[model samples]
Target chain A: MKTLNENAQSVGTILLEIGALLMSSGASTNRTRITMERIARGLGYGIELLITQRALMLTIIEKDQQHFFSRLKRISPHGANFRIVSGISHLSWNVMEQDWTIAQISEEVQRLKALPHYPRLVVLGMVGLAGAGFCRIFGGGYIEMTVAFVATVAGLFVRQEATKAKFNPYLCIFFAAFAASLIAGTAEYLKIGTEPDKALATSVLFLVPGIPLINSVTDLMDGNIQNGMVRAMNGLMIAFSIAMGLLSVKMILNF
Target chain B: MIFLEIITKSFWAGIAAMGFAVLFNVPRRAILSIGMLGAVGGLIKFTVMNFDIGIIFASFLGATAIGIISIQMAHMRNSPPLVFSIPSVIPMVPGMFAYKMMLGLIALTSIENTDDYLQSLISTVNNGAKAMFILISLGTGVAIPMLLSRKESIKKSKFNKKKEVTV
Candidate 1:
């Protein structure tokens, strides 16, 4: 009985760990459940997983349906990391096709966890250009686009610095939005651009929580109503944070 | 001249999509494809909207093309389709509409007269509903391929063949 319990506990830890990784990396709830299940089946066990925005509850059972272990893992804050999601999906196929051992799978997970993100400078510059694109698409003139580009780079820098300082995520968003809007608003005040309103609108477009909004709707359609509602609420809260930031800038500049 | 306009607009849209792809930390190999698909999606929407087809329908058409193309790309790229579709469609997201709706609602709340109140309400509702419907269309458009794939699983096909063989 002791050996059986120990064995179940060891495998169950990895299963729950992988599930939490997938969930936090922006796998849709349905895909999270499916991937966890596939990995468990490959290891000759069965699983029942319950995913929530804050935590994941898992049950590991014998192949013949005898319950063995139940565990709950608190997920870290969610971030959109598509590369991790794809890596785990590919890992699942290998588990089935190549019949990987638990040891091999865990090593791969570690490797995935260590995959280097693009340099911070590249992301900031590219996203700044994206802000300029938003301005152009909104019919801003070249000057407005230039203002937006500068504002976005500044805003994103503030956001990263705040996040690094360990502020609340929503507060980071608020500060970023405020910084972006203030620059764009100052440009508007100076009459530096044609259609500065478009610049103001597009300057903070980088922080719109687009991924969460789309994932929320996708989750709802997949019948993961609870996770869907949580994600939608998160998106709304971020949107509201952005609005408050912009409103504060408007009040300060009194434009 | 119109072609030039479309080309420039789409080029920027692709850049925006690639920007988002980096933010999402998509795989390195998929980034270029994500950019090209983003441009194509934007091109279709702009071309369709030029004909007065309307923003909502244009978004649906653009998103559907993204959906179809993302799925085809997924098989070749070995990544989930959503990894491509989500960031690509984001360049088309109607964020400004929502911003307008919020401001309009604030205006409606403080109006001094009934006429102003009605005007505020009209614009607020108009922008809000437009944003809502466009979002729904984009969601449905993107989901169509994944949902449709439900009936095309290999296991289902294999099961049918086995039944036919037995018969």
Candidate 2:
């Protein structure tokens, strides 16, 4: 006989495990949407809204004097069971896909149990260092700025493709270049009292754009609390990756 | 030597900038054009600012010109300006400037010196205001044309609307 608190904790842990599995199994964003819809329906939430980035937001609509809020609260602790990994895949120009596959979805949950996020940090760090070194040898004010600009554009274009070889490298280079250029140049201008290497390391280290942060904040401001918090958390994780990369570089370079 | 270095840097920067712009959803045709324009704008702005041009005025002009050029590129391809403007202008994001201003404010505000505090507050406000102004101006410049185009599109589709009305 577990207490409500213990049940809630178990639910939260399980939901996280499931989400991780879905993410690892490479389950498409459409599956997540369907699962969320089913959950909302099961919870007696009559209103459903889909936002950009395939975010599933549910609104409880009730007629009569029924206490719907109470019902929602009772159901929310178990809502994690409903989160599905889903997104709209753009197959080609003017061709979009929203296919759902539930069997492999569980694999994603299982995959989450065996992976570490630190490798991503290391990879990002290597990319950043390579970008910095290239820019140091070949970049200046305009060059540095353009690298980031181009990278952002690249990221946007290739976002739909899951395969890294298809588009990630070009985008990474662009992102890294602009960040490195700015970090190096600004350090020279501000005279921030630290050694040049240290200044560059700290400055460009956080240049990774917190796209999720901006998106989450906008979603929260628009009153989508659940979706907003999710995005914000994801953004925080990305920010952490950038921090780890920067710290690693600084330590290695002895800056 | 400097010329060679500048060229090499500019080439890589242009490629990287364009690559990013394209990756981020900017149309492929406009990627290099916008990036090169940005590189040129930055170079032009930096050069002009050294000779007493106000930083605000310089940055504003650079961004505006880039915006206009991106819009023109969009028009040439029979596409909307939304795609080009976002990617083309991304190179000029003032994140570093904004961060520095924040850091300066924290340091100054924390110190006991009244004069330092005043200067930090002023710098923070100035940077913030400048950043806001750039965004607003960019928005306004793009929005005006988009609105006009949408209206024109509606007017052209009057026949479809009439058919719907009758149905």
Candidate 3:
């Protein structure tokens, strides 16, 4: 019985860590709750979970002995990585299906945590291509698309470097937008693109907080109002920062 | 010509969404599905707009399509709906409207004439409201399908059955 109690506590701690990572990585409140509940159920515990934007609390009652574990980990704002979220989701489902021992679950969680991200250059290339694609969708010709592609590559490089240096997220976005717009605005000055306006607009589309905005609505609809509001505010702030960055470039270029 | 334009635009939107999926580090197998969802959503929005529907309504319809398709993809991929929904909708974000609103706000302070200032103010308000409405519509549209399907998912999952038995 003592051994079981210890195992349960370790599982609780692992769940909390996973919860914190998911929230910080931009998972919706609903996802956080569902994942935690599944892990607790898989561990064969009757658990109560309390979740907020900043903290997670889990309580388990076994044989009238209540075990409570709470962790206060501030969710740092970061880009969404669905790979990690999906990995954790699969892990919990496997736990329930396989009835895995505590040690196996912990090892799996650690492996997911340590999964290496894609190389920086590849990410930069994709961002550039995405920007170019946005330009084309908005009716830009080849010249505008090329300009957008180059500008996005440069801009995302700046953003990546800022992120690596641990700069504030808003600051990182601001710098990226500033860099992207400055480059894109050259289309207007040089009269190279048939649709300079489209080039300028699409170059900065990479900075939009589409995921957070969507997640906020999901949370609000699911009755997690507090978390929804917090996420909504964060999304708005990022949008505001991007606007500021772009406006500065526009002001300087007099475009 | 119009049909060709739609096809080209949808293709670009799909490509853009796939790029975004990569940035989000979506699992390799799911990228194509996400791209297809984005293409369909973008196509729907564009087609709706061609009928003279306002952008807000068009965005709503597009997001609803995305939400529905994402739910289906989630079932097929064995992952959450959000894994498909969020990146797919990236192409439709009202980024231009938001930027224009901010531009108008900044430009407001520089105008010396009262009439010009009022003009900028009106434009700013108009653009700002449009952006806000579009965002709300996107959110509401995505939420509707998810909300409707939640009960079905809960009832079908084996874990929930076990949960009931234990209780």
Candidate 4:
């Protein structure tokens, strides 16, 4: 038997949980707010939410009633996983159209979060192919593309290992970039290919922070200045770390 | 000959987008479509650039195509358009320019002479601004399609309201 207070607390906690999941899974602030609001409304509550880069502030009040709960959840850091973003979106629509218990929603959230990633070999192979494709787009020859492929694979392997070891996130990117450019720069040093410099340039691109840069602009345009700036700074810092890695290789190889 | 070139380049572009889609953990069901959309975007950008368009403008055109298509696709799939559009635009990202910008900045630190310094500054600014503008164009282009459709829907709803009033 749940008291009204217990119900209210549960609802508030679920909203916070959903909000945290959205924020940490690369959703824009506006989307997170809208999704949380939609779910809260479906549960007969009104919500006021404030989103920051590292945390969310939320208040849930019962509809046409005085009962309300407020809490804040700190998001560890965002890692982009659009699959979760899409799953939550679909769930929100379902909630809007059909009645769902708090427990059911919690179960679904766990399911979505537990979705498996692509196999490691497949990911590594495909990204390597992407690197070679990038080399081709940049007018590199087959030798250059091959060199880019190998370099990119090696670099990504380093990044994956660093991340698995729970190293700092930016440090992982730096290490990956350093490994990639070092491999590519060797081609430049040995004068092995027609466009080794281009290969070197393109091989480090897997760490470009594409989603963050785009989302930063999207957030800015949507008037989420705080989150936008945070995301922009985040993207720029990652790019800078990559640059630092490349600089290290360039200074070492004079390429 | 040009057709084959476009096909080849766009094919690689699709592969690039697929890789990124996987990287971002876009849903499994949507990966192929994301790749197709990315190839189409590459085709558009490459074709536009052939007509003497700048890279920034070409990329905007490509991104707008992605935005409109992805938004419509979202209705059919019951998911947000961002999931589709973000990876689709990966092929058009200015990664090379960003790398060049970084290289230029590095060169600036080594400052050999006035001429060398100026060259480094120019290279850095040129590549950096180009990268920034390309990214901006892509973001705005993707947004424009959604904005345009919203207005259309509003107008249709207003027209429906008028009909109801007349009845």
Give the top-scoring candidate (DockQ): 3
Model 4 residue A9 lDDT score: 78
Tens-place lDDT per residue, model 4, B1-167, is 88788788888888899888888888888888888888999999999988899999999999999987776566555567788899889878887777778778877888989998998898899999999999999989988865665542211332132321110
Q: On residues A1-255, what C-alpha lDDT tens digit does candidate 3 reach at each position?
A: 233645566766777788887887768887788777777777776667778877777666554456555444455556788888878877877777777667887798788777777787878888788899999988899989999999999988999899999999899999999999899987777877677988888899999888777777778877899988987888778888888988888889887
Q: How well is each residue in A1-255 modelled by candidate 4, as lDDT tens digits?
A: 123433777888888888888888777777788789888877767888898988888887775567768898888874678888888887776676676778878899899989998898888998898899888877788999999999999999999999989999999999999999999999899999876888898899888888888888889988999899998888888888899999999889874
- Which residue pairs show collisions in model 1? none
After superposing candidate 3 on the true structure, give the runs of residues whose Cα lies further than 4 Å from its correct spot. Answer: A1-6, A63-65, B152-167
Q: What is the DockQ of candidate 2?
A: 0.09
Residue lDDT tens for model 1, B1-167: 88788778888888899988998899998999999999999999999988989999999999999988886677667686778998999998877776667677666767999988988899989988987788778878888766775742222332233321110
Looking at model 2, residue B68 earns an lDDT score of 56
Q: Estimate each model's TM-score.
A: 0.93, 0.42, 0.91, 0.93
Where's the lowest-lDDT run of ten residues in candidate 4 chain B? Answer: B158-167
- Which order, best to worst by TM-score? 4, 1, 3, 2
Cα lDDT tens digits for candidate 1, A105-129? 8899999999988899999998998
Higher-ranked by DockQ: 2 or 4 = 4
lDDT of each: 0.83, 0.39, 0.80, 0.83
Individual DockQ of the candidates? Answer: 0.42, 0.09, 0.49, 0.46
Model 1 C-alpha RMSD vs. true structure (Å) is: 4.3
Q: After superposing the true interface residues, what Cα RMSD does each candidate give?
A: 5.0, 10.4, 3.7, 5.1
